[model samples]
Target: MRILRTALLVALVVGVSVSALAKADAPLIDAVRSGDVSVVRALLDQGADVEGAAADGSTALQWAVHEGRAALVELLLGAGADVTATNRYGVGPASLAAENGNASILERLLDAGVDPDTTMPGGETLLMTAARTGEPDTVRVLLARGADPNVREELRGQTALMWAAANDNAAAIHVLAEQGAHLHARTDNPSRSPGRTFSSTPATGFTPLLFAVRGGHLDAARVLLDAGADVNDAVSDGQSGLVVAAANANWEMAAYLLDRGADPTHAGAGWNALHQTVRTRRMNVGFGTPGPFAAGTLDSIDLVRQLLARGVDVNARMTRNGIRDGQRNRFNRLGATAFMLAAKVTDVETMRVLLEAGADPLIPTADGTTPLMVAAGLAIWNPGEDGGTLSGQEDEVLEAVRICLELGNDVNAANYRGETALHGAGFRGANIVVDYLVEHGADLTALTEDG
Candidate 1:
């Protein structure tokens, strides 16, 4: 089977080289494909352009590098093929060799004076490319050859540190940092700061700090803060590391930022950390979260309790103004009464903790989505899929509904989409929830806009 695979690969290479030669200077590329080092040497000896590019901008050296023909690559390089020259897409031979995980060929090119830090067409440096492809050896080789660890790409100014952080390449990130990669440099948030232009400023005004937090790298976050990096540095989007930590449910990092003077009040400011917590706890599965410390070891419930105890203002608002045209709406606009995020497994406990922590169950979300509504809506999908109803626990959803009602939740409140909790229940075929709501005197005659 292995022999068959080898033969197939060889045939494919031959076929591709023949096709490429049919278009432009195919013979040299074919010789490289066939691993005919002597033939490649002869072509170069005859003054055929070793660096002469094909129609796709690939030189003979690039074909050799792609095929892992180390000796052929060396021969082309000896013939003065521009080892640093990039193809049309900016991927040079070094970068391709790294992509193919050919560390030996990469070292040969580097030793022969090929530039390892060269950027491809889209601004990916050979080092960045190597790290992304999980070629740790190639990464080491590039770094040893003085590839700029802190080199920022074109669009977002992401240094190798940022790339490693975003991809959770801890070892590569550490190597670059240990080699004096700037940990505090910021990159552009193109998603938030659209229409922004790139500048050569060393201070990208956005650093790798928040990315560390977003990645939930507690150790990395500690390292950055210990290096005197700003714990409260805000991104171009006006969000801080504290906010990202909370978004990622990195409580340890969140707690660390708080200890370092991170203001949780600045988080979901108009919405509040407690408010965001309620929403986030609902997406626990989506976030790949582990349940809180322990059922008693500080479960999600206890974690919420701790944040509140730490002065995360439970009643804080997320946005100041109400909704408007062409402007973002604040999460606090849901009548500033009792609100509920959509239900998830952790949300049940989160709701219980919030009620215990003084979260107003009366205020609806900005769009009039209520806690009971969320509970009922989630019950319909059986999001927990624990063979349960919308209320989750045998009585948990009902208990939460009862709390909201006791806290003055308008059982008749309708969302902006004109759906009520009962409608949501009926829509999702949650008969248990429908029956429970009816028993609790829930209005059944209410009609929604969609209905």
Candidate 2:
């Protein structure tokens, strides 16, 4: 009984002692976190440990640096606070200072022997971080302190200029360029083996200008172009800035590139800018949301006009089955033309535009699937979707079908699989298209190769 009572007494004493220690530590940390310089100094005078860490392993100096409190940082440093203390994320005072664009705090950290080019866990450098922050002064400080402007990160082999361009930091781009950053440097492109096909993921082989263009940063792109960037530079798959702009529905950027001497006829491995523009327009506006055309839609139309005026082939065809959302499907898009893409989505206005521009309606896919057949629901381009049609778009699709037939298309044309428009209409349960095809002399007894 006496021993049990002694053990309880010791437990009570230990608990009180730990509580007292926590009380002593909390005030200093709270003072530092709140940027209360006087209170932090008072706590230091009261013999608080300078190296005491918060719950996340952030020391007083690190917190001061993170808070951008230069005076507090100086005080902590004078009190012998550890500058190298890191938090749970491996972020130290220097990293916080660099990311916050606090040049003074970063300078102090550097004066305390921190490397100006300190890298994150992923090998991203301080210059890259500052460049992404869009603060030119922070980037300049890092560069002046010996950070490499052209240093490539290990992950993507991207430089500080690439980071700046990607984040739309025009000032940082200017600074990096003035400091001799390689304006034409390309990111690492993974080597493709022979006979091995790659998806169009935009994963590699991007220049800083391509990054800017892909991000839709017109200002950044302008800065890059002014810096003598090649407007026709392409990725590994041969997609130029103009093609990327068209694919992303960034018609403004596309127009800008065209104005700056971008090649309108540049064809990537998959599709040209025209095909991408049609496909992306469908994805953006959807099948039939009834409203006035948006400003972006108008811009896209204008861009299409510009491409046509620049001698872009209105009858251009896709060279390969480009990247799609679902790759497991049996949909093959090779030899598809812009007019065919417009018909597939039942885009009546776009179809009109293409037709007026002399887009051939008789062009077919590799399997001989014609634009008229596609308009009659003859193919499943993206399976599990309603053949790219919406609830209120039956009339528009029927109009597209009418336009195709009026263009002298053969209604009884069969693909390689012996499937006609009637087969596709029946498979899709498109009663409107089926009735129209029957009235237009579509063969009712026509059977597929399977039949």
Q: What lDDT score belongs to each candidate, Candidate 1 first?
A: 0.61, 0.75
Query: Where does the lowest 10-residue lDDT sum fall in candidate 1?
Result: 194-203
- The global Cα lDDT (0 to 1) of model 1 is 0.61
My TM-score estimates for the predictions, one after another, are 0.66, 0.87
Task: Measure candidate 2: CA RMSD.
Answer: 9.4
Off by over 4 Å in 1: 1-55, 67-70, 97-117, 130-151, 178-180, 189-206, 217-228, 246-265, 283-306, 320-339, 342-346, 363-399, 406-451
Q: List, residue by residue over 203-289, the lDDT tens digit for candidate 2.
A: 667898987877678899999899989999888778888887776567888888999999999986667788777766665232232
Candidates in order: C-alpha RMSD to true structure: 8.3, 9.4
